[model samples]
Target: MYIEFFVNVTSKAWALPILSSLHAGIPGRQATLLTATGASRTSFAQSMEHLIELGLLERNPGHGHPLRPEFRLTEFGKESAAIAHKINSVSQGEDQDLLRRAWTLPVLASLHTPGHFNDIRRSLLTITDRALSQSLKSMESRNWVHRSVNVDARPPRPIYSAINTGGRICQITAPEISFMQR
Candidate 1:
């Protein structure tokens, strides 16, 4: 669950700090903690690859070296981490007052309506419009939800619906379970 949470925020860019420490000489150090609090080598590599593809991270800037390029966060990568922190603070109940307000958000009760973007936005304690958009897109891509796009205007408006059709919005994906096995 924690890994999934970070995946949403860091989007693989979460591995930047670990990769940057390649030369630090800690051969078997745990880079990030999973929701279960277990750390493994495979998950770390996979996370690195995911972030690399997203362009949130890249090989170290130095051109010539025998060592693999160190990983570093792009500007966007930092922003992503910041946004994740804000969302997690509220969602994880780190802030009592914020969480209370978020619970009152209409989308929490009526997520079936495509027109509830504003409500969802308001419920999040500190997430930006961009993060909300990304979360919706990620949820839609994972088949947890469906997006209804309104193409009748200059900027498209998207409404979301549960893909499960039974109101299920969350599920453990195969990779998530696989990580646990490691």
Candidate 2:
């Protein structure tokens, strides 16, 4: 599912930045990703290995020294990178600032359909209640998510939904979900 893909890509702090750098015209080499993303050597190596393991990146068999492989985005990686590009483009101002934080995209994606706090938390799997609450509040402030109270219930329940702008982000990132599902 897209949530799984979202988690996979975001699990590493440097993953998005590496993908963004590559998509932004940086060469697909360790040195380039490292320089562009400003990731420490260890983090860069780990992130590159993770991306390669996830099938998002493939090393060029004939290029570079064996110890320093030149990488390129696979078809799946290209699709994922494109979606990342769109996500970056769709966000602005506070929304853009929020997207820089971990779990922001996944939270927005989870709210594609209206969900209660528990539902969104369940979708994210690894997110803590506090983190989810903070993310949702930040998104609410940015107008990316709308929260409403279900007073009709015995106990009022809060429901969260993606606004049109949030929906646009989810739509743009849909390919990542499909790509990972494959």
Candidate 3:
């Protein structure tokens, strides 16, 4: 249930940053959030709309000009925002970019224990084969994940494990996320 919340909140690239910024006391105005997040206007707007749709955000009834409305976190959104804020606090500069991607954290959560490609896929459930492959490869290049061949297995499978910053993030999120285990 909590993993679903994380995955849903992260489906949009700018979503977590927007939520984290809100939680950090950055006023929930669109222009301010866009500037703070450094996201393009279009993507930022889309993400904002997505958050609203997900019931994480709402238009503040009496704030700002109509054309420049302010938003606020809903009860559920506040919970999610705290998690996002904690995760963001651990990363800085360039790492922020990677953390905002759709599958990164959820994938890292799946990698908390070393597993094969299929194991990760099964855990994420909604991730496609291509997306999982690409995410694993991307994390591997960053040394966030280490891949080793399991020669003892009949087919010499590749096992994936979160390491370094990725491992830290996995641990940070482990308490909230009870991901499906093989």
Best by lDDT: 3
Considering only N, C-alpha and C atoms within 3 Å, which residue pairs clash in candidate 1? none
Task: List, residue by residue over 1-182, the lDDT tens digit for candidate 3.
Answer: 55566688789999999999999999999888988999999999999999999988999998889989999999978977887888888776878878888999889877778999998898888999999898888889888899999899998999999988898888878876643221
Clashes of each: 0, 0, 0
RMSD of 3: 2.7
Q: What is the C-alpha RMSD of each candidate to the true structure, in Å?
A: 14.7, 2.8, 2.7
In model 1, what lDDT does residue 39 have? Answer: 27
Error of 1 at 57 (Å): 1.4
- Candidate 2 structure quality by residue, lDDT tens digits, 105-134: 888878767899999998888999999999
- The segments of candidate 3 whose C-alpha lies over 4 angstroms from its true place after superposition are 178-182
Q: How high a TM-score does candidate 2 get?
A: 0.80
Worst 10 residues of 1 by lDDT: 97-106
Mark the regions of model 1 whose C-alpha exceeds 4 Å error after superposition. Answer: 1-38, 62-69, 93-182
lDDT of each: 0.43, 0.80, 0.86
Write the candidate numbers in order of decreasing lDDT: 3, 2, 1
Please give the lDDT score at residue 173 for candidate 1.
24
- Per-candidate TM-scores read 0.33, 0.80, 0.92
